[model samples]
Target chain A: MAYMKDDQRKKLAVDVTRNSKGATKYILITISVLFVFFMLILPLFSVIVNSLKEGLGFYLEAISTEYVLAALGVTILATVITVIVNTFFGIVASWALTKFTFKGKQFIATLIDIPFSISPVIAGLAYIMTFGRSGWAKPVVDWINDMLGTDIKIVFAIPGVVLATIFVTFPFISRELIPVLNAQGTDEEEAAALMGAKGWTIFKRITFPHIKWALVYGVILCTARALGEFGAVNALSKTRGETFTLPLEIDALYLAGSADSITASFAVSSILVIIAVIVLILRNIFEHKSKANREV
Target chain B: MAKARKFRGGRVIPGFGLTFGITIAMLSILILIPLASVLFQSFRLSPSEFWGIISMPNVKHAFATSIGCAFIAAVINSIFGIMLAWVLVRYEFPCKRIMDGVIELPFCLPTAVAGITLSKMYSTKGEIGGPLFDWFGLRISYTHVGLVIALIFIGIPFVVRAIQPVLEKLDSQYEEAAYILGASRRKTFFKVIIPELRPALLTGFGLAFARGIGEYGSVIYISGNNEKEHTQVVSYIIMQKLNYLEYESATAIALIMLIISFILLLFINIIQIRQSRRTNNI
Candidate 1:
């Protein structure tokens, strides 16, 4: 058989009908572009413009209030704790699921996916059922409170906020890592093991480098979810300004029914929108890198 | 014990037990305990009590509103999402990357933020819905239509993400062949392309449906939370129940929502499994 060169093969594979550029193609493309513009771009543009429409001074004033500042702090704190805890779990869970072929592996994988399916509001309710003042473990909590002679509020406090955020965002990092790790397999790690490298050493020298980009991508996703979490946070938050995260504050302000409060809500929303834009950009970069890696 | 031991495949890397232990421990503590508590609390109620909670008119209506609206939104999303994915994949356009990035804005943006944004836009005196209301007497804010719009906003990304890769990797030769064989473009698209994209479409539909059903943050603001009608959804009802210290009732509703969502996810999983099987066969 005669061999075809690369350029010839590529040219032959190109479909004449597809490149002929018919009217249907143009019509469909126009409809799609228009849909995306009206549905997505327009609303986003409205938010950004309205947010700054009150001018820079009003925007800054709205975001710089004590409650808003506190909400910002709580949001950052939650994101940090969520990222740290989920990263560890993501690494271990992905390693166990992919590197080891244990019984109930499929079950555990399904279990990890529970958070994604359940409502975040319901998740907050579950936490309250466990740790609220009238929760099942109330007696235990009271015992600890009496023992320590200290008042620690779990349900309506920072702890509850952190827990709900963790529950909602738990699957992001692990979900991202598992496919990448499974695709990578354990050949290199096993090879390193055979060469007498310790477990940590092998992980550091081998697995870390391969999955680092994925890890960053997962962490970024986890951070975004943590920052944006609302339903669970809302259910658990007393909204007393002390326990309010940024989303909670935004909701509170929006519902406050004042001209100033409405503008303030827009300002806070603009902050979240800014964070979202950053996440979107980072995701694009990582997605491109991962696609390149896969092609290679 | 021997059968269980046999399931562990041969791997020379160390820390299997350590990783396994951490995984199980964290999973149990962080996920299982909280999830199980909902079931446990629901079980604490008598069967009749459970029935009473779930069968109440309000409860029934909330469920109907959420599931019904989400279904409608998912259908709309499937259509527009396919179109969006096709445009992004097939055409060479300016700001394509920007368009792709913005599609994911909902996934990262706080739903509360989205809720306010939508409510503001669609409010009776607002920019978009103001003219909408004045010209047509369309009261979108605090209406079922608003709720569906919010659901669609959050749901669009799922369908787009799900279908984009499938369209990108789709070979054009098959379409060309169909055309050459005297099949019209419409026929080729409906016959050939639709079948190829069906699984992804279904999976995306289910995902968007599940997400819409479980959604609370965005819908709460615009849903009006009206006790007069069925504007309230199951998640909002659950929050209301909790607010009144009705733990058992909240758990009961949550358990039901969880069960429905689980079935939806299971359906998606089955689709994915079959998809992988088909790919493996190919």
Candidate 2:
């Protein structure tokens, strides 16, 4: 019996050694982890480290003047308007989506996803063709320009920039809100209504809590995308470097053959990185809480 | 309860009518209007003119390089993306959270920033690119090589993120069962895990490819975007036309890009439906 048991054990050991699978699996996994680790951090590291760089301070000095300041103000102004308009519409649309069902329901959902799927450059061209020199927007603009004698370059101006950003980011909020409302179920809202809650009261007390974190997530992502949007703005017209956003400013610097401006680009980018990290952490928290609550 | 039953007037789920109305209006303004405008403008161009435009040596080359390079990048990203997603989900290791954080960086950073940094680093005198150029003559900038690298950088995250969720949802029991039967891990993964991941993997690849096709920011920095068959993409060509105030030709090129994207999207959508049906049968 002892001899038989020893033979079996030896055979098992040989089988394990011959398989040679475990080592291969571990190696594959290690390579994957390292690849992601490097790709994600490397460029980010380049940006953050390069920002405070003393190597390229000369060019950074050139663009740090009032010109960039105006660009910064324009960026912030565009972002603020974008967020306000998107949020108002995003909420109303999400609410309407959650509150009622009508014809072309699926079609609408598909349409919202279009901005996400198509190229941002195409979006820029669309705005230009529809609103530029001989665009559909031309008549309105000519009317306004003739009446007020004020030039409104909606195709190249801040308003155009704002509109483009809005198109690019419109989906973020609704996409976030829909999933949360769908998952939360209607139990609470029905209960609130049963207690004589009006539409506003129910939304304020019951529905809002279910979706607040998702709203925040959507808002942060939208803000980031808007702040850094490039393709549309670049294609539309960057006639005046004075009107350049930080990103466009970076592109200009790169074009001008000054490498130091890269660092300043990273400095502003680091702020975005910090915001992204915070949002990710919040997402983790919200997800964990929801999962735990589901178990309870 | 069931799918159709869930839509029944429960008073709590909100009415379908209101949701449909707002959604359509929002979509029409945001998506349909913009896309249709491009098509409408393109209609002004004669067929001969559109064909003549595409036959131009420079335009033809840009289109070829853009399509060809985007494919290469998407393919490379798919392999890496699949491996990356698998590792993140299957293993518990030190700095796993940090790894997770890093995988998401591309999604967070501006494409322009990514482009600038990549272009600089790959320059002959730039940090990483310098040594590579010196040792192997693997010049990335002002070449098709550079365009591919930029697309790979911007595209990989989509594949990884898309696949990761599906990976996490997968049950580990299948792997365990294969192991119990003395099947090799390689066999188990290929036969069991990979089959399940096929749909998601393809979708991710399609998305990354589509993203690569539209790429403008990152590629512009790395690829000289010179009209000389060097790094110029179709989007750059369109920009040139627009810059020259040649609106009709610009719209024509854009219209071509639009159709290609739509066809590819349709192919993916069909595959998705088939995949869902197959899964339901299982």
Candidate 3:
């Protein structure tokens, strides 16, 4: 206690009053850390704790083995299909928007933001109302079922999940790519064409490289989003034993009131967090590289 | 710039043809079609009935709760975002990089995870929510308060990211000039610094507001939706309709929100444009 001299105490009081940047900075940093602790770190604590108990063995013994795996498979399948679909759509849309202008160019740019504004639950319901049991696509689905005889379904199944995820995630690739492409310009494309390099050749040699890193970053984000997709998937699919993603699995486990079953959900989330961290690090690298390039 | 290479009809550029054609098709199918479908479905009800459906106390409550909570959250963000950004820009501090990363958490963490985590923290037995409730009997879980906190969590980053760039872009000369004239730091900030930031601040506020209006996942767990009372939000109302097989009602609700969002965004744009013009005149 004596180590805190009267002079030192007076200096501390003076520092607080005059607003020493260091002391205030410490308070600000602490507040920020508290924010992160509340927001990012805490939720992760629960997930990590749960995941610890969920060995690959817990999954095998607890439930219907085939059903669980199929659910797992369906989740991956949906993520893959959605990523491919959205990436292609986003790329083409961005590429097209950059390379051309027409009567409604501004209108179309606004339209591209539709997915961002849309709630996933609404998006899911949109698909269902359009193509679910009492939908416009019902007859088409029925005809296919009749032709194929009973083993096929679209709504409330993997196909529906894929389509819904694709719809909800469309803006990712286009939003990232359009800006990069717009900045890149059409000079090279024109130059390549003048040299008779052809459309595909021009894209491969020039356009692709310019946008490749951003494309990867965007696609990774899109994929992570797809993996953790919940609201839309929840709306579309029922019968958790039949169709469930990792988040849905967690939802079901929580609702079923088994603390132990929650383990599977946590394990899946931990896996996703790991994947996301890797993707985010890559994104950060590309972003910093682009900034550096701009400075140059 | 060549008229010959412009590919006819006074088009801006040659590739415009292909781009326009593709963009229009994509927009029509993917964007316009779904939104239009929502409107078309909403029209399934008669005029008076549509009003009744939309103006139900439950629906109105949901709508109001969502708007009110979101507004509160956005206001908090506006204040905090500005302060946090100022701190980040103006000072050198320990673990400053970590502070930078923390702002982006609302962006990176999955919304579902956010919902679950926040609900646990604010429940009757958890850390902060529990302590506050124990002290004052002011519960956060399953209440309007919980809804706002959830929203504030998700909406903070939108404003912070938006304003951080603008703050960095401003010239510090005005602040110095004000200081030389003997203005207080507070007066200098309000006079010199804030006027420059108004347009950017408003734009960030608009984005955060728009984002809050559409937020669903984080709100749902904490909101404790009873359908007829305080907790239900517009997005959940849409979900409930989908659950009830009332497709028209669902679409109507979503369409209404979409229109409101459009108007808010348009208003923000107009203000920004006029402000920019005024500043240029100055």
Candidate 4:
């Protein structure tokens, strides 16, 4: 009878622990969901609601303003140029750092990551100090402009905006590619070199295929960042319609302090919101593709 | 060292020179030269002059607000981040994939959009802020409390992303052993699980803290930037200097921030290296 009673107590203990485990799981899930909902999801939802607070027609008119369109153009142009330039740099840098051994390789890698740590405002300020009037590079910039017989501005212009975007996003593609390339090792490339195959040919046939998804992944991230770049671009792009990107335009509109403009700001923001959503979806898809490639 | 030099020279790659040349040239033009400009501009000021600019009461207050808020936000994120990472990795739930994807929204979304939306939502008349204020006489937007809320929003992804992989790769055997050794669930989690998660948690905290410290866009809208003593952040101070065209002062302040960032980066890198060494040893 005493042994039976002990067994009953043990079963009760197991049942109590199981119930507590279930309670813990549900509580954790609820807290996480609530936190994300309040912090992330709710704010994003309000953007849509606030954008349409007036009417569908107002939303359309807000987004169709000339300045908004121009800002959109600048944003797309900067993103495209940055992606092309950085993609080339990323490919070459990753190739050099991973395919061969060299001095200061670690230093170079760290240098590429410098932008990630530096504030965007500092990056923009650095450009202003470099190419603005009284800057060290002012003479060089003027010489180039004089030689070309063209009046070109660097600091408070499109060039400065693009330069800042590039500085901020310089590391993304290379950062993504480095690990994949490092994991690939150099055995195949060495064998191909031994067979008298040229670098371009081997890269096209082997390396390109391997890093294609990763490159796409990197480019997507870079494009998203460049498109949304505000702080750096803001420090340099002082003029509204001329130099502003989408994010800057949003800031200007919101700070305009009229209810109409605030609504308009949300309206303009919805365009970026849509683009960000698209980018996020693409990022998810490409992330999975890259992971699958790695697994294989 | 001699053997290493030989191995370096023995690389079979054909485009080493070509690739290395492009990489160095671009790196110098895009990164090194521009950053040097900040350093050189600040160097033009005397040490006392530099100290005077960054040590102003307003500037000191801004720095304090920024660092203090960022630290608190990072701490809060680390706790919730662990819970989120645990749920995502260990629990099966509906819409888990969608939830996972939503975590990257802050990373991809324009900071301006996030700034505006968050400010509106937390403003006195808005959805969440309305009830909050009425029930508790608490205000969020246009205050330092609002600043922390914005920082917390931007920082969520950093902690979660940092801890997710580590949590996923954790061996459950240790936890089972602790449990079987008669430890309660709380004891097992605190003693066995948390110690294992320490490196990842610290990494997430560092990253979130660093990001928050440098954050400008999201905080600016909600921070009610008019209050110089309470809500002004270091980044906004730099912006204000630029608006007045006080380039030297801006660069000096930026230099201070740059130094702090480098120290934090070094700290994180050391942690990562140690973590890797430990993993390899095991």
Candidate 5:
């Protein structure tokens, strides 16, 4: 113990404390990394690997089946429709909220965010209550049927599926655009108006250029969400093969209680996972670009 | 002054009348009517009937399990999410961008996919669960723990994203001053850093908790759906009731969920407003 000189002993004491602190930091980092790896990354890798566990023949066979193709078609159709409708509403709502001052403006903003908070199941049930067999829309359905001599189905049909999708995804694009437009403000828009530019022309020349990326970002997110919708679509889709979207098909296959169906569930999940990865990549790029633009 | 303001041109650009009209019309048809109809339908039942449905022991149990699991999951996410945000902000590491990107997977991935994948990975005979059961006699899947795990999976990104930017924007001078004053790192962290992070933390917690409550797809498979075991969530129960053609009861539960969610949403909005006000002041 007495072998070391006084200053050297002090230096050694300092070294020990710093080393212990370093060790603690390393432990914390290790735990954080391991937590993410186990909780997030591992399950993702397992799903992807399980999808390819069978030979290429099995995978292709599973994916190319008639049911799977139909499910894919439904998902694409729903996503395209959701993106278009929601994109239009998003633009108009954001434009009005940002470009104009009106009574209950704050109230309207809060109203748009309602869909985000409500459960998808509740949203589905809400639709059912409004448009199902025992719903408020029975009168409307009857009127249509009597007037047109045609039975038009709203609930438990494709229209119901599309409406529920729209309901669940209603807020995504508008929520995205509100902040961007709010920040960009009325200066450019007001200046363009002063130049005798009409609404469409002003939007095309000034507003659209600034908001094009944000619109795409919102549309992509809306489409991703719309494609993956389940509970709402599940409520409206009582007929299995007829109303099933891709996510519903995955759930159906998993619940079918057969080995082949279970494997196919994994395969379908692989497709959704691939789409999610693409969305994540696009989101990252948009985030980077927006941040750079903000700095400028 | 306000009256004069109201009488003036509503907007600088044209289409105030047209755009406002369409926006409100779309909002009404798409969001307001559908959500309101559930409440209106629930109102059809007499007061006694409303009480009868809500007072069911199974319904009570479902609410308890759903809210309880979500609360527990949000708490877990809050602690670990803070650690994660701190790590991401305070240190440089390999594959950091990938880690950052991956945090939002729960947001983009379909909840059903998350549900099935989680169930497969955590079932008793599965990879993580197999060794866990063999080593520790713990069964996660088809249990309350599994349900909480699923919620935590979906809720983690909310907390991490909420805190990351706040941590990045936090000034280092506060920590440096605490250090120079001879306060230990632990003391500085608890005293200096956490206080500044409280708003963001609360917002994240509320967001995660609300999301956890409304979660249906990711939790259904992992939860085991054991009504007798108190694992069935309200959302699942609503779906079950609908399947059974019990519209009244389903609407009743839906209304309950709607009320709780609206309260939470209002709370988060308040926090956000306060937060923005603070940033603007700064």
Candidate 6:
């Protein structure tokens, strides 16, 4: 009778602990979900809501304005060019870093990550000092313009916008590619070389297949970053309607301080929000694909 | 001959010369040379001149506001980030995948968009701000409180992403052992689990802190940008200097920021390397 009573007591203790554990889990989940909602989801929701508050026609008209269109064009142009340049750099840098045994390799890798730590505003300022009038490179820039018989302004121009974008997005592709390539090793390439296969052939057949998904993943991230680049581009691009990217245009419209312009700012913001959502979805898909490839 | 041997050490694959040349050339033109200009520009000023610019009261106040707020934001992020990572890793909730995916929103979403939306939502007549003002009479937008909130938003992903993988790979055996040894649940979490998570947590805190210090776009809108001592951040000061065409002063401030960030990153890198080494040894 006493033994039975002790067993019952132990059973009750276990049940109590388990119930408390369950409560703790529920509480954690609730708090975490609420945090995400308030900090992230709700603000995104408000953007869309306020955007259409003046109705869809106004939203459409707001986004289709002449400056908005020009900003959109500039943004897309910068993103495309940045993507192309960074992709080429990514492939080469990752290949060199991973496939070869070289001194200062780690140093070089650290150097690539410099842009991530540096403020984008500083990045813009750096370019201005590098190429602006009275800069060290001014004579070189001027000579290039004179030799080509053309006016080519770098700072406060489209070239400056593209350069700033490139600076900020420099490491995304290579950072993604390096690890994937490192894990792949160079055994297959070595074997192919012994069999007298050319370098291009080896890469196309062996290495390319391994890194293709990661490359695309990197490119997507770079494109998203380039599209949204604000600070660096803000520093370099001066003429508002002529050189403004989407983010800058949104800033201008918001600061214009008219109620109509504020509403228009939200409308412009919705376009970026939509692009960001699409980028998020694509990022999720590619992230899974890359992880699955690594496991395979 | 020594160089040749070094090159031959891992030369099984071809195209080393071509690829390496391309890497160096592009890196110089794209990154290194441009950044060097900042250093060179700062050097144009005498040491006293550089000190005069950065040591101004307004400049010092901006740095203090930036660093102080970033530190607070990093602490908040560390606590909540660990919680979020824990919940995502250990719990099986509905829409969990979507929830996990949404954590990266701050990363991909344009900061200017985040800035405008956050500013609108936190303004006096805004949805969240309106309710709080009606009840507690608290104001958020254009205050120091609003600036920290913006920094927190910019920093959320860094901490969460850092902790997630570490939490995922943590072995359960240690926790089980702690429990068997009569340690309570909370005891096990703090003693056994937290020590294991320390490196990742520190890494996340460092990264978020660094990012918050230099944040510009998201902060400029919400921070009101009017109150110099209370709201102006370091990056805004750099912009202000540039607007005045004071390139030397701008570069001086930027160089300092660059140095601070590099140190933070270097510290994080060391922690990561040590963690990896320990994991490999195990």
Q: lDDT by residue for model 6 over B41-157, one digit each (tens)?
A: 898899999999999888888889899999999999999999999888777779999999999898899989999899989998898988988889999999888999999999999
- Candidate 5 residue lDDT tens string, B120-215: 889888889889999999999999999999999989998998999888777666666777698887887899999989889988998899989989
Q: Rate the local accuracy (lDDT) of all candidates.
A: 0.86, 0.73, 0.71, 0.88, 0.86, 0.89
Q: What residue runs in model 3 are displaced by over 4 Å at the alpha carbon?
A: A1-27, A50-68, A140-152, A194-196, A261-268, B1-15, B179-181, B227-229, B265-282
Question: Against the hidden reference, what TM-scores do the models get?
Answer: 0.94, 0.87, 0.85, 0.93, 0.93, 0.94
What candidate 5 gets wrong by more than 4 Å, as runs, is A1-25, B1-10
lDDT string for model 4 (B113-224, tens) is: 9999989898888888889998998889999899999999988888999899887666665666677788898998899889998988888898889888989889999998
- The residue ranges of model 6 lying beyond 4 angstroms of the native Cα positions read A1-20, B1-10
Model 2 / residue B251 / CA error / Å:
0.5
lDDT tens per residue, model 2, A160-249? 887787887778788778767766766677667777877778788877877776777677767877887888777765755555676777
Docking class of 3: acceptable
Q: What is the DockQ of each candidate?
A: 0.61, 0.47, 0.31, 0.55, 0.52, 0.55
Lowest summed-lDDT stretch of 10 residues in model 5 chain A? Answer: A11-20
B174 in model 2: Cα distance from truth in Å? 2.6
Please identify model 2 stretches exceeding 4 Å from their true place: A1-22, A55-63, A95-104, A144-151, A185-197, A259-296, B1-19, B268-282
Of 2 and 5, the candidate ranking higher by lDDT? 5
Better of 3 and 5 by DockQ: 5
Residue A118, candidate 4: Cα error in Å is: 1.8
* lDDT score at residue B244, model 2, on the 0-100 scale: 87
Residue B168's lDDT in candidate 4? 65
Q: Give the number of the best model, judged by DockQ.
A: 1
TM-score of chain A of 6: 0.92
**Which has the better DockQ: candidate 1, or candidate 4?**
1
Q: Quick one: RMSD of model 6? A: 5.6
TM-score of chain A of each: 0.92, 0.80, 0.82, 0.91, 0.88, 0.92
Candidate 5 clashes between residue pairs 3 or more apart in a chain or in different chains:
none
The iRMS of the candidates, in order, is: 2.6, 6.1, 7.3, 5.7, 6.7, 5.6
